[model samples]
Target: MSKISFEGIGEVAATFACEAEVQAGQVVGLTGDGTVGPCESGGRICGVALSSEDGYAAVQIGGLCRVAKTGEEVTPGFAKLSADGTGGMKKDEAGGTEYLVLRVESDGMVIRL
Candidate 1:
């Protein structure tokens, strides 16, 4: 089989902030101080950043998204935050907080919350 990617599958939510640019494909989490960065366990996994930008970054909140996998293989089940504490998604067994895993793809898993 070949790789697959899908965009614009859900409602897009974004806001303007003073934080630095957010890169695409990176898991973004809203910080306690009202900023965005790589998600961490327990931190809110908002969605994947659309692209790198200084302000007004677009975030994909719901639906299917092609994200970068943190560790080993993943299955269709609960999605776990990255073990490295970088807010990335990993297989539930990777040692991190768990979230509902919608669908497990070869490159990443689709999360909805």
Candidate 2:
């Protein structure tokens, strides 16, 4: 997929090789091999996958991006987010990186990474 960029929303995305199949909107992280893959629980988030084909994926690394969520409730505000181990996001009270959640949609939340 091509890199995604928006005029004023500050969206930043880049293409990367994937270790395995990654669906769009799934949270992903850098693997030990430096390839991107679905993030595991507590894994450091690299970005949200915008598109995936073959062994490459377009990952949104910065700015507002929509992503799936776990059963845990998330609201609009600043909150720590981490992978749910199955390509979804969950609130991370344990703390580390904090992302700004702009809105909670029926499908997912819009967050600024």
Candidate 3:
């Protein structure tokens, strides 16, 4: 038999219309335009999804979860942000300012909100 390849992805807690393409394990947030995309500063987060899609996608919006890492190692207490204002988590910028991190994980990272 010829070698074959496939992709397996799951759904999330809640389903919402996506303003942009969202990937599994990516940090998602609500945009000012009232659509779910990627988490960014000064924006509200929904949560991480289980799969990647363009239009309508499932969002978790709560609880401990696994998110995509944005080239940054996150510990139990590290703060995170949406990578490039889209999916994926990255370490918050330098500063002890508030609103540093949206979700803090004990082992991994919880989704958006």
Best by lDDT: 2
The per-model lDDT (C-alpha) reads 0.60, 0.80, 0.53
Instruction: Judge candidate 2 at residue 64 and give its lDDT.
Output: 78
lDDT of 3 by residue, 3-36 (tens): 5211122333777777656667666777635357
Q: How do the candidates rank by lDDT, highest first? A: 2, 1, 3
Off by over 4 Å in 3: 1-12, 32-34, 39-44, 52-54, 78-86, 93-113
- What would the TM-scores of all predictions be? 0.64, 0.84, 0.53
RMSD of each: 3.6, 5.1, 8.5
Q: Give the better candidate number (1 or 2) by TM-score.
A: 2
Q: Which digits, one per residue and each the tens of the lDDT, describe model 1 over residues 1-113?
A: 43654444665666534246466767777764546776664344666777657655577766766665666677766656552345356654535566666566666666653
Model 3 C-alpha RMSD to native: 8.5
Candidate number that wins on TM-score, 1 or 3: 1
Tell me how many residue pairs clash in candidate 1.
1
Candidate 1 lowest-lDDT run of ten: 79-88
Q: Candidate 1 local accuracy as lDDT?
A: 0.60
